[model samples]
Target: MITRILLAVDDSPAAMASARHAIELAACLGARLHVVTVVPDHSLSNLVTRMGSHPGVHERRDQAAEAILDHVVRLARASEVEADAHLLEGDAARRILAEARSMHADLIVVGRSEGLDRSTTAHILEFAGQPVLVVPPEVR
Candidate 1:
């Protein structure tokens, strides 16, 4: 029985697919869904200096996270599963792994780039200490 699930979501088709799949699996297994969205803290436009291009970048990222969370919530509700969403800041892989450990997640679902072949898949496979379900973009 999967009691808790961590769905790593981002602004990508593959992530959306992963979220949907996680919701379905969680609902079927009577598991609670936890959506984690991470935004890079030091991206190009988010230099955090006077010359940064957009001052509202963080706000925009937050809004995007909120929107994505809302969508996940709506999906989970439709599936009759309890769901919680969170906005985090950090590197993608590290944040996902840390959240899984912190929240005691039974499974971690992530969206994988289709272009990455076996090598990348192996690399990701080695990173997760828990079961990881990597959904490709086509599924999203």
Candidate 2:
């Protein structure tokens, strides 16, 4: 009954692992995949610009987010699963949850990076009504 899957990814090794898992799960379940990447809020970017500290920071982040989405989407399509990409701006956890609800996803998938704080994943688990699958970093 899990026909729609929402995958939140970043440019991290763990996220790549999660992308692979998501692709496999989608293919097995015949589910449509929705891939999403979030950038920092526009207001924060503006503040940084105003401070004259990091010009083009937002642009770089956007480009990186696009690349991440493109890579994941391509992988999903190669597995013959229908996939859509979303580039969102704002809080990562909130945006992901909203997208899940917007797409009516049956499940959510995310990656837990090694040594990184788990606040984002924790928030998602605390609020997401649907089941969530957390993929750990691939051990080499």
Candidate 3:
């Protein structure tokens, strides 16, 4: 009965893999896809320019999120699924969880990168306590 599925994606290879998997699943289940991307509230450019590294951190993060969101929307359209996209700023896992709840998603899909960040991603899956699909980076 997973009519609504949320995909928590970044621009990583693993995330892209998960997005593709989510597309296939959505098509199979006749589900709607809710694609969301989160950017950390910090910008390298602002950090270097302002020296304060405070202003526009959120802004830059939001911009990155928007780009990822747009990518997801395009993916959905190509896949021929009813889909929508969201851009948010904050911790990736937190924003993803929030978006899933707000969208009333029946399931969530995330990607696991092949680096030190993998443990952090694992922690997200453990902490979220919701059904999550973890796509490996090599799956693509």
| lDDT, candidate 2, 1-140, per-residue tens | 99999999998888899999999999999999999998878887788889987899789879888999999999999999999999998888999999999889999999996554389999999999899999999999
Clashing pairs in 1: none
Q: Which candidate is the best by TM-score?
A: 2
TM-score of 3: 0.82
**Clashes found in each candidate (C-alpha, N, C closer than 3 A):** 0, 0, 0
Which stretches in model 2 have alpha-carbon errors above 4 Å? 114-117
Global lDDT of each model? 0.80, 0.92, 0.80
Q: Which stretches of candidate 1 lie over 4 Å from their true place?
A: 114-124
* lDDT by residue for model 3 (1-140), tens: 89999988888988888998999999889899998876655555556558874666655667777888888878888889899987776677777777777777789998887777676577678766468888888632
Best-fitting candidate, measured by lDDT? 2
TM-score of each: 0.85, 0.92, 0.82
Model 1 global lDDT (CA atoms, 0 to 1) = 0.80
Q: 1-140, model 1: which lDDT tens digit per residue?
A: 57999988877788888888898899889999999887777564457635755588778778988899889889998999999899888666677788888998888888775553334345546877778898877721
